[model samples]
Target: MIDSAVALPQGRRQRNKARVQERLFEAAVELIARHGYDNTSIDEIAARADVARGTFFNYYPRKDDLISEWSARRGTELRRSLVTEAGGLEPGDTVSRFHRCLAALVELNEDRQEVNRSMVTAAVRAGCLGARESATAELFTAILTDGQARGEIGEGLDPDRLGLLLRDAYLGVLTRWAVGAEQDHASLYRELHEVFKVFLIGALPRTAHRDCCPHTA
Candidate 1:
């Protein structure tokens, strides 16, 4: 007879492991948001999650690892949304598509403003914001490269440089909004749309055929 004690099923073990990881992640986010990153401890996270300290170690080697993983997940989601929303538009339509996507993103964030602010605050305190910045740069690079190849974006602008500038611009705007520096998201978005319109007009290929004229609404 097989020793049941010695032979734990793989599937059950995997499910339990996944559940533990999820709990730990949730706990980390909550604790960090409440106490700030530096003050949060692994033991506190484990206690809050109702998991043993060993389980926390098994899931994340360190508290910072948890923060990094969480930040990466959030960054991935944002990148996916940006790519999905912007992918279908032609190169010349990049400006309008971007404006629409930005507006949608702003709306989404407003609904989850507190959580978003908490995550941003935790990430900045942990120094993981730089990783997020790099991820944003890469996402914008993909967008710019595709736009350029399709003759949608202007020729003189380097994709890498343009990507960096665009990432910084969007991040700056979001930061301001997240910090409550701007109370009127609609007006902020309108101003940004106009700014992007002027910027794109100078950056997009002059010879590119425009199916739609850029308009600031």
Candidate 2:
């Protein structure tokens, strides 16, 4: 799900740095997912990654940097799914495409609910959740901008603002799911869709057709 925009590092030093960063992210995520965020520390993460404590700090100045990297990957995966669901330049149903994209994201992360919960907690504590320039928000904003141009979304709303709001809403639901998943993942998924329905209503124009909205001139 990596975007082509991110090129692989050519030099040995750069490659090694990238590899170490990835290992740190993987180790941190695994630990945080299994144990709660507060329960996991820089020492634990460094040990899990088999790197020295100083090495970990060299790659990531703060523990939250690992979580932020993981979040960016998740956002990229979701964005890729959305692009694929759009059928690549074909006239597509934005609503259906969006649902499919969201479904893919939920399916991808459903098994790691505890990890998601921990990540959310850590992100909030580190103020990462408030970052408007996050990959997740950027991707949503791009999609919403297209939807607005195509008359699939409400004209009155600013695409960037609406996108941020939608992203926040989804993140909120994700936190809720991570914290309150006493039942099966399917039940929690249903709640996500229900919340999305409200978002759809808010985002779409009132005159939008039941099946798919008509394009504007």
Which candidate comes out best when scored by TM-score? 2
lDDT of 1 by residue, 1-217 (tens): 9744346655787768767888888887777656656677888989999988988888788666775786567655666656555444333356665765566556655654555665556556665434435665665666677778878887767888776776667656666665673477485576556656755765557676464355622
Structure candidate 2, residue pairs in collision = none
In model 2, what lDDT does residue 56 have?
91
Per-residue lDDT over 49-146 for candidate 2, one digit per residue giving the tens place of the 0 to 100 score:
99999999998897667776777777767766666564342245668766775787687677567787777767777876677777666766777778
Name the candidate that leads on lDDT.
2
Off by over 4 Å in 2: 1-6, 84-91, 202-217
TM-score of 2: 0.81
- Tell me how many clashing residue pairs each candidate has: 4, 0
